[model samples]
Target: MGAYMSEKKYTKDHEWVSIENEIATIGISNHAQESLGDIVFIELPSVGNSVKAKDEICVVESVKAASDIYAPIDGEIIEVNNNLENDAAIINQDAENDGWIFKMKISDSNQYSDLMSEDEYKQFLEQ
Candidate 1:
């Protein structure tokens, strides 16, 4: 796997996920941000909200358009990055890391293994 994508899994919807302990950190992939252009605002979910896999968990608005960010797996949101409220451009600056949208207490760890690996995600994007 590429160095940056080492622990990250990509979704067809342009989201990326990385699990540490039982917490799954979720964010949009770099490709998603590039497509969205300059980000302006974000609507994050409440910290204690429970979400199912594929649920729309957040909305990211950018200069070009607004896009919905979905949950990659079933989980309860444990925390959200409030930093984005003041400066949403952080996503444009770093989509995969510092721009992470939320972290959740995973309900099913096995669901993570089903996401695309970096290489697979690259191929998916090419299709």
Candidate 2:
């Protein structure tokens, strides 16, 4: 998480994604995790599951409550982080990296245009 990395970009509901390639890494944002508190369990969609933008694809349970995690864009889930089943707290440790719940094979990267960039999201948080 040095200069080459980032922990930004946010959805209206507080999910985030960082795309380094054709694949987009997806997860809940720090704000969402903080609100939920002390994650205890996570239910992620199976790899290869097809999900559309805004579709509910996962759930995270924390000391406070259980919450649904939505797909940030239309795509097929390429990978699910098995680490959460054993160590769900990893999401609290690093929501952007180890906490990433899934990797999506976006059907159309252009759809990302509707999401907020890091700068915009940061501004959103301030409001």
Candidate 3:
């Protein structure tokens, strides 16, 4: 594979986004899953659904509560992680990687730059 395509960016709400070839992969952060605890269900967005940045994209339910996942950039949903349908705990195990929730072909790549960097996210959490 080519060198890593993009740095992951984060939302204040704990979603993370990474873009490659115009497609943005989105997932909740580890802190989010840990806080939610033992995710039990996920309602994924449909492929082809168009969304604006900050729009509610899906829902995740844990033993503790249900959390909303938001779109980090304007886009049309292109794919979702089907594994989550049967096993929502995948997110608890790897919120940033194998547990990615959806992929969307972004409407504006520039929006990626506006999100927090990993360092900024960590500092935000510390605060």
Candidate 4:
């Protein structure tokens, strides 16, 4: 894909959030998709659905397992990646970019502080 452009915040659970103009784009990390193995299906939350921090907002099914994708912060979902319905394997191909799951209007800007920076997340993964 294109060069990495966003400053991403990551969770211990393997989700990532990238905010721009109060809209937080959410997706699973590459490490997560690699672990899931050959994603086959995705169930995304509907647009406008209210989600709390840590709520299960979507599901991804792969040949090896099914995993719940959690909301990184309180927000209302404003858009979802419909492309995943037809080709969930995109997640395995590019989990951080073209495979983003949803976009939300963040309810609390401060929640951004709770997530790890790219460097911190890398260290976390090492641990």
Candidate 5:
């Protein structure tokens, strides 16, 4: 597994969010990418799009299947990783870092508290 940031929070759907200065950087968890196999394409939301907690904000296509990537909190998208448009396999190489899908200005920081901690998420995966 790649190095994971201690501050990152994860969703049941296998996305991760790391917040700093009210901006949340979002990405699919390593588990998600591993389950999906070799990712071939990605459909990301445009910058400035409004997304609610649990909203489907993107899609990732892999050799195994296409999966919807959900928002972990309500927010306005501030940026997206355009690099994925050309080489989606970056997700397979490192889902936690360069594979990040987008960044958003969170609507409510409190929403982050509800997400699973790294340990909780690891336990969830074990279940």
Candidate 6:
């Protein structure tokens, strides 16, 4: 839908991460939100929590389904997108930008290498 999202890394599970300034912004992909439909609630992790790669950190519930938002890397949770609690549709409206699920201080940037790049993720979808 809408050509999917651009310029973001992806996971086999369909999570996406955008890296900037050693901080990672994470969310589900556009295709994910389109498929989930009419998001109604989000459950985020508390601040100051430590998260490991692939950890289940959030739960996003939509009219069609509820899914876990996994951690793409090991890191401590510096900030959760509090805005989502009040406006979960922000995620459906702008999954990559204002709707990002969380911002984290990465524990090892090198670990990011294990994730799929935008191009790689695109290929994953083609499969």
lDDT of each: 0.92, 0.85, 0.93, 0.92, 0.92, 0.85
Give the CA lDDT, 0 to 100, for residue 61 in model 6. 98
Query: TM-scores for all candidates?
Result: 0.94, 0.89, 0.96, 0.94, 0.94, 0.89
Cand. 2 Cα-lDDT: 0.85
* Model 1 C-alpha lDDT versus the unseen true structure: 0.92
| Model 4 segments more than 4 A misplaced | 1-6
The digit string of per-residue lDDT tens for model 3 on 1-119 reads: 76466999999999999888888899999999999999999999999999999899799999999899999989999999999999999999999999999999998887899999999
Off by over 4 Å in 1: 1-6
What are the RMSDs of all candidates, in order?
Answer: 3.7, 3.5, 1.5, 3.6, 4.3, 5.6
The top-ranked prediction according to TM-score is 3
Q: Which lDDT tens digits does candidate 2 get at residues 18-125?
A: 775557889998888888899999998889899999898889999989999888889889998998999999999999778999988888877777789888987898
Root-mean-square deviation of candidate 5: 4.3
Error of 5 at 124 (Å): 0.5
- Candidate 5 residue-pair clash tally: 0
In candidate 4, what are the lDDT values of residues 1-116, reduced to their tens digit?
Answer: 54343589999999999988888999999999988899999998999899999898788999988899998999999999999999999999999999999999998988987799
Give model 6's TM-score versus the native structure. Answer: 0.89
Per-residue lDDT of candidate 6, residues 27-66 (tens digit): 8898889889999999988788899998898899999888
Top model by lDDT, which number? Answer: 3
| lDDT at 125, model 6 | 87
Q: What lDDT score is found at residue 55 in candidate 6?
A: 89
TM-score of 1: 0.94
